[model samples]
Target: MMTTTSEIDSIKKYKTNELIDLLRKEDLELYTEDLEIIRKQKINGRDFLNKNKEEFRNIGFKLGPALRLKEFAEECKKRKKRFSSYKTKKEVVLTKFGIDNSIKNIPKFVPQTINISDDDDEFQYCIREIKRKMEIIGPARSSNEAVRCLYIETILVSAILIVKRIVREKIFLEPQREIVDEEATG
Candidate 1:
């Protein structure tokens, strides 16, 4: 699939913010007017996910955009379901290999939260360690478990690469906070 936007909020239970974010994806080909109509109609994320093609047409969507939107929503829904089903088991397996969930807030695959900062050299080191551990995954007794481990590691590395590229491009800037002058306050 062509990755036109980050998957930051992909697997979460969707709400108004999530709905608007989904609409903002460039591949959706929706206009601001279309977004206004959705807002005016009070079409929340759940409504967006559940509405079929006919229902979307009834809501005044053009055929092409409607189909694309529906497909996108279904894909997100599938990812959410897949993540939820293995949520606990994934944690246990990661923990067994001394992996902790330090990575958080990444909007990418692996179905787990990942947070990386521009200056996070430690994260790069952590990725290396994860890769090292993955070599041991092949010798595990259960093929199924080994496969899952390898899959997770691959996804994790891919997510990190994406993040690193984003950082390099200056696309993922940290939020700016206003610096208050102590002298002025005093």
Candidate 2:
């Protein structure tokens, strides 16, 4: 959303240092005032609301990267497998059997294993590994177990939505650049 002159002026009423400090502290009072300033400035209602919505969404967005872990854990639970230790090379191979069995029982549980992996790569690699394993196991039953699985899936989906919203806002709401006549002799 575009920041209007009046909004800018209102924001200016607070000392720059104070504003910076408040932002750092995540002071809700200052946030409320900022919202009021934006409202008074007659900024586009839709854009303002969208921006505010995304601002709220940002809180949940950070959790997105972590959802893969949760989903993997849930999938393991659904297949009656424990998501335990894998610190050593031997542990990985031994644990693979239980994971494979779980996958065999619940195919959907197979893909979920794709989410797991070594620490060297992005943490998401572990999540991807879990997911891959889940796919191999096949689809899960649509009973009580399914209900619990759905609940976990919902949380993961929410996380993904939060991340998407944050990315969209960052890409679209960033300030535009002004053209400079550098080529012309000053």
Candidate 3:
């Protein structure tokens, strides 16, 4: 992960020039020691490992966020499995919902149990429910089919409600009609 001035010869001229320009702009020399070029590391501000675990205890953050070392280690193990399973270059993604393979990088550590005290958590809870429902299910079942089934169930419920309302009206009207007939006969 650390790069020294000695590796300068092995690097291409254009790259060296680029680094040279970057360091020059920062008023630093290229031959400086202890220069680190960490590979495969993003310099984003969202460093879950560095974030204090207690911040989550006080704040309203959802999910584990992998704050502790133990949690992060477990997350790493899960990610290694995912990366191994989906090794092809096409499966790698940058964000959660940006691309088709966006979910490929989600480190599926034991899914965090969400505490739903309010109504906001209901949507995520329902999605997790679907996950559990289709968990034992095979890849043969399509998402379109799931949506179709839900729509059909909605229609069936509406029909049942309509039929029940009609039957109730008939029952209430039949009693009134019988009383009128009895009075007319009397």
Name the best candidate (by TM-score).
1
Better of 1 and 3 by TM-score: 1
Model 2 per-residue lDDT tens digits across residues 1-186: 223444334443554444434333532233444444434444332232223344433434234322432343233333332213224565465466655434444335443222323453334544564466467644445464544454455446544544555456533223224434665422
TM-score of each: 0.40, 0.15, 0.15
Runs with alpha carbons beyond 4 Å of true place in candidate 1: 1-18, 87-186
lDDT of 3 by residue, 82-162 (tens): 555654455444433355565655566795453434343434444455565455553335675555554444445444444
Answer with 1 or 3, whichever has the higher lDDT: 1
State each model's CA lDDT, in order.
Answer: 0.63, 0.41, 0.39
Count of backbone clashes, every candidate in sequence: 5, 34, 0
- lDDT for 106 (candidate 2): 37
Tell me the tens digit of each residue's lDDT in model 1 across 56-164: 7788888886787778777766765665566576677666666665445333566545566755665666566666756765433455644665556655665656676
Looking at model 1, residue 105 earns an lDDT score of: 33
Candidate 3: where is the Cα deviation over 4 Å?
Answer: 1-143, 169-186
Sort the candidates on lDDT, descending order. 1, 2, 3
